[model samples]
Target chain A: MRLPRVEDIEKRIPRPEDFTARSRGPATTARVGTALGIAFGICFLTGLWSHFQYSSPGWLPIGPNPAWLYRVTQGTHVATGIASVPLLLVKLWSVYPRFFLRPPKARRDQLLDVLERASIGVLVAAAIFQLTSGLLNIVQWYPWEFSFRRTHEAVAWVAIGALLVHIAVKLPVIREGLGASVEDETPVHSDGPSRRAVLRGVTVASGLALVLTVGQTVPFLRKVSVFGVRDGGGPQDLPVNRTARAAGATRAASDPAFVLQLKAGGRSMSLTRDELAKLPQRTHRLPIACVEGWSRNAVWTGVAVQDLIALVGAPSGSTVIVRSMQTRGAFRTSELPGDFVDDPRTLLALELNGEPLSLDHGYPCRIIAPNRPGVLQTKWVRELEVRT
Target chain B: MRLVRGLLLLTGLGFGLWGVWLMRDFTSEQLVSMGTFLAGGVLLHDAVIAPVTVLLGVVAARLLPGRTRSVAAIAFLVWATLTVAFVNVLSGQGGKPDNDTVLHRPYGLSWVVMTALIAAIAATVAYRRRRIAGPPRSR
Candidate 1:
């Protein structure tokens, strides 16, 4: 007996033509593709905004006034990603026929088919990577060794590029399918629901996916957001990513001998937590907009970073590097740009809401800046090196 | 239109290839693992998930006649999509150790309740469709 080749096995399996559902056609594919494309666009833009928080490229300037800008962008990123899951599935299923499509007879047409198939494969792979990696990241699961943030950003460009190429290739088909009525599309013989039914099903599924997990950012919906990763419950009603125990900062942060080291130029000054608190205190109600997309606004009272740096003779245009007492982690120290240092609202926060900072909330002191990701908040501050 | 299409294709290819090129410095292991995941997702969906969905639709259609067929389809769409989206959460990984608030709900129970809720809604949809069409009439 001859060995079965991959193609032979594939031929035995159900091809796209085997799917006789009325929903699996050009009309349904076009409609779902339209929705999925929009979702992908929104997700891509917002994801870029969130990624900028980490790299801070000079060309794209993000302001501090809208303390909720990162909140909105990151929130939209995760939510749109969640919503896109169903639409993506539906879109792929509707186009499953393309996988089984044979090459054309002419050499040029065959070449074009091969190129289209290759690009489609790349697009599908990149899209799935972006969504799945994002979902896994939010829950802090790293099954792979590669850096999620770096890999995610790199793949995002690939995905968007492939999407644009796909649009270019299918523009005529898309226009034709979209322009004509769904009822008028070329259909395979089937005993299934109308195109409208499939569309409605996809919409409802996508919408459910959104509302079910968006409560992490939209506070009011927390109760109904059954699958929301972060419930917005922690110290001072703020969610915690790295706690005192988790960071191994409990003992070091609680030490009475602890003094925040403030350095400017070649000089350094030290102040105890109480002394830092006794200095001119300012309160800024800023949101701890975490990278994981959970955010909550809290009233934080502490010494302004500028004021503390001023005592050490660091001027208005100075940049400060906030260092944490946390024994372990990637963001042990974060550099605040001149703009952030000059911002009057930036504080080395000592209190949260109306109460003292909980151990999990970076007790003693934490950096709170408007429109900043939580990781850079620099909890359990041990040093502030101001450079003019 | 030709110019537009060409520009789109070139820009897309240029940018995409550049991105892939930039990551050339990643360790061979990292690259391999990344490729595995990227390719794995497409493979799993195309080979297993899509076929399973098609099979489910066939089964649902055969088991239920008339309008209830649509009900089964919609219900499966909602439940399967949501479940897959929250697969990590349902897998007990969402509730991390030492953190009480992250994915705090009993997800297994949540999944059960969610399934029942979907079934209930599906039953209602089936009932309404039955009333609207007043049962299947022979051709």
Candidate 2:
């Protein structure tokens, strides 16, 4: 089918030059885009670190020594993502006129232009996906079947990749825009905010967006982060990912027959809650930092994970599967890596904040270790099967 | 600079394609879900959001006095930009039936506070701009 000529279709769409607003210039776009670039860069790096926690490439050892590492990293990731919402929108508003860019008459320029536009399409789509899906994930809402983590990771790369290419393609324009004044033809009787005022508004609005929702991570800011999914409030003064009732472990956890079993190298040992408590109880201050980016420090008191494994004759630094009696959910059984278990601070916690573990906070027993994801803490822990 | 730009472009395409390749095993449903949001975002912004923004600017310019129009436009820009992001969480779908602590805060009230604060700030800034300039200036 013969398509309409480029000039024929151009009549229906406004050309980039037709946008005459003094504030809607490349300078405003470049400034907002620069801030957005930094936000995305920080968010991507921190998100990659959060991803590495689950699947470490072994280039860096995710040590348990620094209990606050993931807390800070994931907190920054979520906070930065939140802040970028307004930044991205404002940037798009400034750059929207460019979407109507007319094709060049030169064939070579047209080809390059098409390629650049395609790359921009990819960037915009991927960015919108990342921000929207991330927000949904914060609320634990999964409207689709594909894995959130996997798709989120894959699309993040796409966004960053296209973003970098966009920078390359626009480098000359960006340089020129940044050097020039935002005001075109000495302002000439404008109606809305000046280019400078718009930039300031964008910055202030984005900062407000961030400060309002960052309380999930910043302890002192908890009261103000009403939009934060996890409010740093739960049983025993720490957020709980899963309740005993939700995990279907309430009956098993509260039963008088509850005993923690240890198995390693053809040897087996079981100890009741009282028996486990009597074996050199130790207290450690550790934060239950979650992947969703909420964390709280608590005084966890119980037998050390290394000590519990020793009863089954497992050597120190043994890898173990800490299985929870809440058998129905994901991460019900978490692998405690050799290095993590070797640390004396790793504990099968029985007391939280000087009180017995609340029924919702993993009743009889739970795994409390340094720098571990909250989901992998394996609440209502029943069996410690040493693998190494 | 040309060499750097070329290298960046190539590396970017490589990474972007790799991300696309990762979804080779996704079911049709998954792909559709992904595409819906991806394309929907662009369409929503370009077709709906942009046009409304332009229309509002034109309407405000024609109908309202200059000062109120300018301040309102900026405040709307700030509020709408943020509201689009806050819509999902505000839907209350995030709340868990058994767990009251999860998403337990009054987000609706928070949004109201956010709007009031943004309007107040915008008005204050506009008032100061007028005060400092010492005369009513054209936008």
Candidate 3:
């Protein structure tokens, strides 16, 4: 069939220049895009690390929870995600206009547009599910009747995959957009807000988010944190009998007495199970946040691993290894980096909710470090080794 | 400019502070669970789905003309549906969280082998096509 001639189509179409813009600015949407990109990257990495824990254990170990290490990494991952909400909204607002504008120069650009549009659809869906799901997880709420573990796992894959596609499609455009600005004597103009102004707004909002998150997480400002307390509540969150995690049963065996081996910098020392019980213990209530986006808080009591390591003569800046009675033919080890071991609040927790550790809860011994994810905490402790 | 920097700095600082606060109270149980879930998902997805998806994509691409996008979308839908089903199966036990139901095994051996095979084949086909097409006309 013969197609309509260009002259014939002109009657139905608006002028070409009407759809074209000489330049685009760093609108609020653009800034939000940048922020979303960055936040997504952080969440992606953390999520990936969380994934790696299952695929390749010890690849990136955070000290067990209630430990400073676990809390920080896990919390940061959540905080950045929370902050991304505003950032994503603004970025979408800025970039939404581009959808209406005519395609830019090049066939390659057209193809990229196709890829990017699809990616945007996927990204938006994934982000909404991931973010809201994650936030709900923090508060220990599950609105959906679906399986949290499976749905979380599936959504995470979709989200990450979409994210990768989005980045692949947008990278060049982002680079060009940024590069073009530096090259132009006078920056390009568009109908939206100026790039610099939008960026300024993002910068302020992000800063405020940080402050608020910190205020909420920091122990000193717990009373002041607008974001609320870090804990997600208590034991109801933990599985009743999640199996003796390799060494979980050992914790009970050590009840009358427990030994916590402290190793650092290639040196190792042992504390009698009873002696470990005798040491001064610290207890703090904090939330255990997972990358899967679930969180729980409980009263944790234990000798600070940092303190115990010091007592056993482990030097500062030594990597610590926490081993559980739970083993998979040598796959049951978790590493605590030297830096994390030195954090003042790192702990060798033995009690939960002011009581002795339950057998299922890594009884007798477990490592609780702050700001670290839950996976890094080794339960049913048998040995602690420190290395530089 | 300062405003932007201030914002970024503030954001970073906020992360830093939140991190520090989390550092204050540490528990081993939560970490173990988090690690388990995270690792399980990554391993299953990377090792299983990635390879299978790529294989399906390649096969579909070869069979259907101008249907690469559709094939990819199909692959994703299939994967999601399977995951939902698998996770639900796992979730049948008493009081398991919704997240743990579907296991997207890491796309491991499958991912590596499939990706390598797909890349090699694609490269070979492209090379042959270029050779046949010969020199291009100047635009």
| lDDT (Cα atoms) of all candidates against the true structure | 0.85, 0.84, 0.53
User: Candidate 1 or 3, higher TM-score?
Assistant: 1
lDDT of 3 by residue, B32-107 (tens): 4434544554444435644464465456545643312332332333223322322211233222242221122222
Q: Report the C-alpha lDDT of model 1 over A1-388, residue by residue, as the tens digit.
A: 9999998987886655666777666678888999999999898888888878876889976656678889898899899999999999888878886787666899999998999999999999999999899898898888897888889888988998999899899988888779867673554575566788788888988998899899999999988988888888875788889888889899999998999899998989999988987899999889988878788888999988889988988896588888899988899989888888788889999999989899888988999999998888899999999865
Any residue pairs clashing in model 2, and if so which?
none
For the candidates in turn, chain A alone yields TM-scores of 0.95, 0.94, 0.53
**Model 3 alpha-carbon miss at residue A216, Å:** 4.0
Write down the DockQ of candidate 2. Answer: 0.68
- Model 1 chain A scores worst on lDDT over the 10 consecutive residues at A182-191
Residue range A24-90, candidate 3, lDDT tens digits: 2343333456667778778766765555544445554544343444345555676677667556544
TM-score of chain B of 2: 0.83
Model 1 off-target regions past 4 Å? A1-15, A184-188
Instruction: Report the error of model 3 at residue B72, Å.
Output: 44
Residue-level error in angstroms, candidate 2, position A36: 1.0
Q: After superposition, which runs of candidate 3 have C-alpha atoms over 4 Å from their true positions?
A: A1-31, A53-67, A101-115, A145-154, A180-195, A229-388, B1-139
Candidate 3 lDDT score at position A62:
40
